[model samples]
Target: MGVLNVTPDSFSDGGRYTDIDAAVQHGMCLFREGAHVIDVGGESTRPGAERVDAPTEIARVVPVIRSLFAEGVPVSVDTSRAAVAEAALEAGAVVINDVSGGLADPRMASVAAAAGCPWILMHWRGHSREMQKLALYSDVVAEVRDELRERADDAIAAGVDPSRIILDPGLGFAKLPEHNWALSAHLGELTGLGFPVLFAASRKTYLGRLLAGPDGTPRPVGGREAATLATSLLAVASGAWGVRVHDVSATADALAVWRATGSPKFLGTRTEDK
Candidate 1:
């Protein structure tokens, strides 16, 4: 999956593709660059980012989605609002990548159900602005797995097809660096829950912190591409269904290597590095 953030305030690549024409072209480029799915998000959900109204988000993404889907590109709407997801589906989106896992809006499940598209349920405790404060977890892996299971159950009960549900651990949403690492290391536990798992670790803050310099300067967004590829490779080796990455071609290349190499586990056991 290639991430296409259409908001001006997103943590990475914001304001770069807000224009409808630019966004469509970028989506096409990503698609040609080996992106299996192009995820278009209108609002910036970066930590501490303010919320954009549903109408504004819809307006920002609908045209882009319509244009891309018209080209036969596989597009996913990265929205938590039912109205926005509805509009995007109407405009031509085949998936709903809801960061809140249908928690943000009570009607999201119904909308997803009605659309009959894949709905990605990410582990989220709250909205972005207050999410960090809610990252507390007794055991990050177990909590996230169990929470994701609950969400899957709720979505199924709400009329969503079980096979159409995907699980995302929400790496940086409400998780600290350690929490993210724990989830990444133990990703099999989440994937073992029988849902296609999506790991989105592209240029996230924790990767920058992990690669911080001696003086404690975090790595810039552009510098995290290597780390992002590393994460993508490991996540694939660890049984992730897919990775949502910013650098699509790099990830596609690395995945090619993994494929050529017979998908050998690049790193040791999940617990070894941890």
Candidate 2:
């Protein structure tokens, strides 16, 4: 999956693609770069980021999604608003990537059910502004897995088919660096849940912090593609269904290398198709 964040504050590459034309062009680039799906998000869910109104978010994503899908690109709506997601569905998005795990809007799960497309429910404790405060956890991996399972149960109860649901561990959403590390190391537990797992650690602050300089300055967003590629490779190797990334080409290249290096079966297949 290629991340096309159309918000002005997504923590990374926010303002870069808010323009519909630019966003469309970027989406095309991602598709050309071998992204199986292009995820378009209008609202910035970065930590501490303020929420945008539904109408504004709908306006921001609908056109870009329409244009890309019209050109035959696979697109997913990255939103937590039912109204916005509804507009995106009508505009031709094929999936809904909700960071809130349907906790933000009561109508979101029903909307996803009605749309009948793949719905990505990420483990989220709260909105970006308050998420970091909720990062506390005992046994981060098990807690995240159980939390994700609960979200999945809720979605299934709301009429979303178990088959169409994908789970994301919400790395860096409300997680500290140690928690993020634990989850990455034990991703198989999440994958072991028997649902498709999506890992989206693309250019996040944690990666930047990991590669911090001697002066304690974190690496800039542009410098994290290598780490992003490494994470994607690790996730796929560990049986993740897919990875959401900003540097689509880099990841595609790494996966291609993995495929050519005799890991073809694991690097190129999804558990969902089984």
Best by lDDT: 1
Which regions of candidate 1 fall more than 4 Å away from where they truly are?
264-274
Q: Candidate 2 has what TM-score?
A: 0.95
Residue-by-residue lDDT tens digits, candidate 2, 72-162: 9999999999999999999999999999999999999999898889999999999988999999997999999999999999999999999
lDDT of 1 by residue, 1-274 (tens): 9999999999999999999999999999999999999999999989999999999999999999999999999999999999999999999899999999999999999998987889999999999899999999999999999999999999999999999999999999899999999998899999899999999999999999999999999999989999999888889988999999988998999898888865357556354565
Q: What TM-score goes with each of the models?
A: 0.96, 0.95
Candidate 1 positional error at 118, Å: 0.5
- What is residue 162's positional error in candidate 2, in angstroms? 0.8
Give lDDT for model 1: 0.94
- Candidate 2 — which residues are off by over 4 angstroms? 264-274
Report the Cα RMSD per candidate. 2.9, 4.1
> Which lDDT values do the candidates have, in the order given?
0.94, 0.92
